[model samples]
Target: MNINDLFLCPICRNIPLSERESFLNGLNYHLKTYKKGAFIARQEDPVEALYLLLSGSVKTEMISDAGTVLNIEIIKAPKPLAPAFLFAENNRFPVDVIALEACEVVFLPKKSVMLQLSSNEAFLRGYMAFNSNRTNFLSERIKLLSIKTIKGKLAQYILSRARGNYFTFEINQTQLAEYFGIARPSLARSLSEMLEDKIITFKKNEGEILNMNALKELVVS
Candidate 1:
């Protein structure tokens, strides 16, 4: 990807050409490509640079002590990976990032990133907003993890993602189980139970909430 296109990314969105040129001046950056299933970065690796995904998608995941894989998030192209962690004290990746398809990434050194943050108000604000959104997402993840029962977790998941009475899943049940940190069978059973109880109707990736009140009760119960 051309360095000029980096300005199109959310962190640099709407930045004036003058400011963009100013941000790029003397900046040492590298672009690297990865094949599908390649590990872009390993867990606990030092975040020496800001990783900007220029193309393709990747999954952020962590393996549990019991050897279970937890799916953290799927990030698409044109976004920075863990923007908030770039300047963190520990400054290490919390999860492994693996490419879901052929991907191109630009690595901007910490110094360059800091320069952009200090020199461009727009870039700084965009960076802060991106991190704030990630914080909110983590808070919701924590809420889901706190729900002890599989049914309850599934209920909360459905409630959060549903649009009116209808919804569609981006990931399959296996991936959903990983996200919920539960056994696949457990999640499957809960879905079956919900269907049998007329609380929801799920088929393939699409679903409908048959009993919205029941789902609400399940979430709080």
Candidate 2:
């Protein structure tokens, strides 16, 4: 699909890129399709381009020296993550990005992005705001990972999804395991415990939400 037709700037879903011609035209950009499970870029690789996901999902991960793969974050459709080159000090990617499904991405060269940002105040503001939000998200994820118990982590995750009085979304066991950085069996045990405690509910093929007040109590107490 043409970048213009996509309309939604995958990085900032609420903003349409068609309105940002100065930013779009200044960059040497190309649209590329990636197959499911394709590696978009590896950890420590030079940051040459900023990618905007046009379709599908991607996961960011890092492998430790002990060969343990730590799943850093998952990028859903219509959002972008880890545009490392926008920062002067981030010359290389700190984690690997892999397509979770067949996807299309628009790649904008780093040099062009820097040039455009230098001359366009509006684009600069938008880019800065994006990075600021990213910083806050990373901070929260770090805090979540620091929680020692599986139940505590699960409680935090559910609390994050709770909006007003409702909480529901699609997620599978494998995805949950990846997000929690634990084995599937361990996640299963934790999930079962939560269900038994009446902290949350779920069904096969359907995702889950929480007993919000119960979840909050678990999180605090």
Candidate 3:
């Protein structure tokens, strides 16, 4: 994608021409590419620049006290993350971002972005709305992780994927365990239980949804 097309304001997916010009004028930002598995940013890194994913995928993660990497979220192409932190009082990144595939990104200096936001009402409003949505998403994720039982967590996860559809996204057992912050064996046992209960079924390398209603009941029970 052209860098212009990729220029999504973190607060709003689209950037108005006036706002875009103002941003470009303030920050001498440029697009750069990173290979898969490359570290885009490290935790607690100085909030130097804001990042916008132009192409490919990225994952945000944090290291726990025990030094285990806890995956936070997977970001797809054309999405923006982490710019919100620049405007926050902390001005520090809470998690690390890694490229999951060959990725292209746009980076703008924090000072430049803030300058533009201060003078631009439109950009400021978009920025605030974006942060609000991000906060809500994080709140829901916290709720998901609060479930006591592995089976309950898995059920809720599967139901979330199904959402009114019969197809669920394919994810390997290892990835599932990592995403849920559970041990491999515990995740395996939970999956077996879910399969036995007819809540879900799986193909060799794909996901299948058996009963969404039953999965919801399992999550709540």
Candidate 4:
């Protein structure tokens, strides 16, 4: 699909690129497809350019020194993938990006990125706004990780997503464990403990808050 014909991306959505012919001409962008489990970018690799998810999805994987692999987040299409580091001093990827399925990505070169920044005021503004939102997201993720107990982590996760006392987690137990960066047995044990303590009442995908005040206290303390 044509880059200018498309909505561009979240950064360029408000400021359409189709109208800016001169700005559009300065950069080169093309599509690339990757098979499932293929590494789009390895950990510690230099940030080459902006990547917009054209179709399908990808995940960010973080590995500890002890080889503990934690899958951080899944990014869906039409969104920029980790462009915050593109302008950093080191400008290296902190995680390994892997395609979850057969995915298509909009790959922009570094030269194009530089040219867009120099020539397009709207692109620059949009890029800055994107980075600012990314900062907030990272800050919240750090806060979630900082909670020491399993119950605390679970509580935070539910609280973050729940509209009321009721919330439905789409991921199964195994996926939940991986998302929480803990073992399956440990996650199950914690949930069981929470149930016994009357902190939450869960059945399969759906769960209701039994003691929201306690959960809130758990998150902060």
Highest lDDT: give the candidate number: 1
lDDT per residue as tens, model 2, 8-53: 6534343444546655667788989999999988888877777788
Q: What is the C-alpha lDDT of each candidate?
A: 0.88, 0.73, 0.76, 0.82
- TM-score of each model, paired residue for residue: 0.81, 0.73, 0.69, 0.74
Cα lDDT tens digits for candidate 3, 31-129: 889999999888988777778788889999989879998778788877776867776688778899999999998887777677867877766787778
Better of 2 and 4 by TM-score: 4
TM-score of 4: 0.74
Clash count, one per candidate: 0, 0, 0, 0
- Residue 201's C-alpha lDDT in candidate 2? 77
Regions of model 1 farther than 4 Å from truth: 16-19, 35-39, 61-74
**Candidate 1, after superposition: displacement of residue 8 in Å?**
4.3
Q: Write out the backbone clash pairs for model 4.
A: none
Relative to the true structure, candidate 3 reaches a TM of 0.69
After superposition, the stretches of candidate 2 with alpha carbons farther than 4 Å from their true spots are 12-19, 33-38, 56-59, 71-78, 99-103, 118-122, 200-217
Return the number of clashes found in candidate 4. 0
Query: In model 3, what are the clashing residue pairs, if there are any?
Result: none
Question: Following a full C-alpha superposition, what root-mean-square deviation does model 2 have from the true structure?
Answer: 3.8
User: Model 4 off-target regions past 4 Å?
Assistant: 1-8, 16-23, 62-70, 115-122, 162-173, 203-206
